[model samples]
Target: MSIPKRVAERITNRIKQFQSILDAQRARDVSEADTVTLVKDLLSEVFGYDKYAELTSEHSIRGTYCDLAVKIESKLALLIEVKAIGTELRDQHIKQAIDYAANEGCEWVVLTNAVEWRMYHVLFRKPIDKQELAQLNLLTIDTKQDECMERLYLLTREGFVKSALAEYRDRKEATSRFMLAAILLHSGPVQTALRREVRRVSEMLVDPAEIDKILRDEVIKRECIEGEQADAAARRVQRSAEKSIRRASEECEGSEANPNPSESPPVQDAH
Candidate 1:
């Protein structure tokens, strides 16, 4: 997505300015409370949030509070969990954030330590899950790089308003290795195409079953084809294929039922 020129410029300037603040904070080894304050400032100054209105420290879920919650127009946009500047972000931090999001039925959360920011998409499943959409460190990234800038832009106010992060999440899921692997392994059309190519190249007929076995056993990695993520991808592909088939069938039935209205049957009888 192309960010507006003004927003892009603001991101560039803030990234540079925050790099200095992050450096000083890390040197001082600030407390978690201090880090939360820095994060609120970052949200306001860098991410285009109103400090007093949009950013909240009192958003509680199940008797616990998220460090910061971004609410635009009184709707919760995202939950942020902060760690101390000197502390390393870990899975535990993400779990806490995800718990808050799950209870509130929110889909997005962020974990930051005033320097490194990790954005996650929470899946409220039987057991809650999360997908890390983007991770960036202000001190390490080149602030002027477009890719880096774009990543930061996904967390900005404009990005939220545009649903850029959701779009990014969908794009990531659609093109993920597990999704691709699932398509290759389970998609019937893909299997047929693979079989045809094998016969054309080797001058020998290959059964679709044989091709599937070879791809699953040798060509594709086991991890990509055998995991909870892989299963989810496979289910998504199956659902998509089923929908396509249903639409085609419905169109065919409609065409058969509705013959050409322009054709007149026995119009000559009137003459």
Candidate 2:
């Protein structure tokens, strides 16, 4: 997604400014509280959030407090869990961040140590799940790179208002390995094409079951073919196919009913 030049400039400038502060803080092994302070400052200066009004430090959720929350116009945008500058961000930290988001019915969460920032999209399913959308290290990020700027933009106030982050997550999931594996394995057209290609190459009949077995057993990763995530991806593909079929059916019926439907005449401008 293309970010506005003005906003991109601010993000570039702020990231450059914060890189030095984060580097010094990391050298001192700053405390979590100090890290939160830096994060809040980043949110305000870089992300265009009001430090006092939009960034809340002690956000309560289910009798526990998350380190920081980004709330704009009284709407909660993100729940963040901060770690000390010296601490490495881990799965446990993401779990805690997603837990806060899940409890508060928030869809987004962030885990950061004022240097490395990780953004997650929380999925509220049978058990809460999260997908890491973007991870950027201020120390290593190149402010001049368009990709780095775009990644940082998704966490900014303008990006949140424009739903860029959610769009980015959707785009990531749409072409994800799990989604591709599910489509390759279960899609009818894909299966037919595979069988046809095999027959063409070998000049022999290949059973569908054999192809399926090979895919399930050897070709695709076990994680991509097995487990809850795989199941969800398959369901999503099925739903998309179903919707396309329905739309085509409706269009066919319309054409059959009104084969020569009249088109609207163009309106003339009254200049």
Compared with the true structure, what per-residue lDDT tens digits does model 1 show for residues 1-271? 7889999888778878888889999999999999999999888888898999999999888888788999999999899989999999897888878988988999999999989999999987879899899999988977577888889889999999999999999988889999999999878798788888889999999777788889899999999988799999999989988999999999999888877867776645654
Model 1 error, position 187 (Å): 1.9
Q: What TM-score do all the candidates reach, one by one?
A: 0.94, 0.89
Question: Against the unseen true structure, what C-alpha lDDT does each candidate score?
Answer: 0.89, 0.89
Which pairs of residues collide in candidate 1? Answer: none
lDDT for position 242 in model 2: 91
Off by over 4 Å in 2: 259-271
lDDT of 1 at 215: 85
Could you list the CA RMSD of all candidates, in the order they appear?
1.7, 5.7
Model 2 lDDT tens row, 1-271 = 9899999889888788878888899999989999889889999999899998999877788888889989989999998888999998887878877877888899998899988999999999968998889999989989788888889998999999999998999899889889999999878788899999999999999889999999999999899977888998999888888988999999999999888779766799999
Candidate 1: stretches off by over 4 Å = 264-271
Q: Candidate 1: how large is its RMSD? A: 1.7
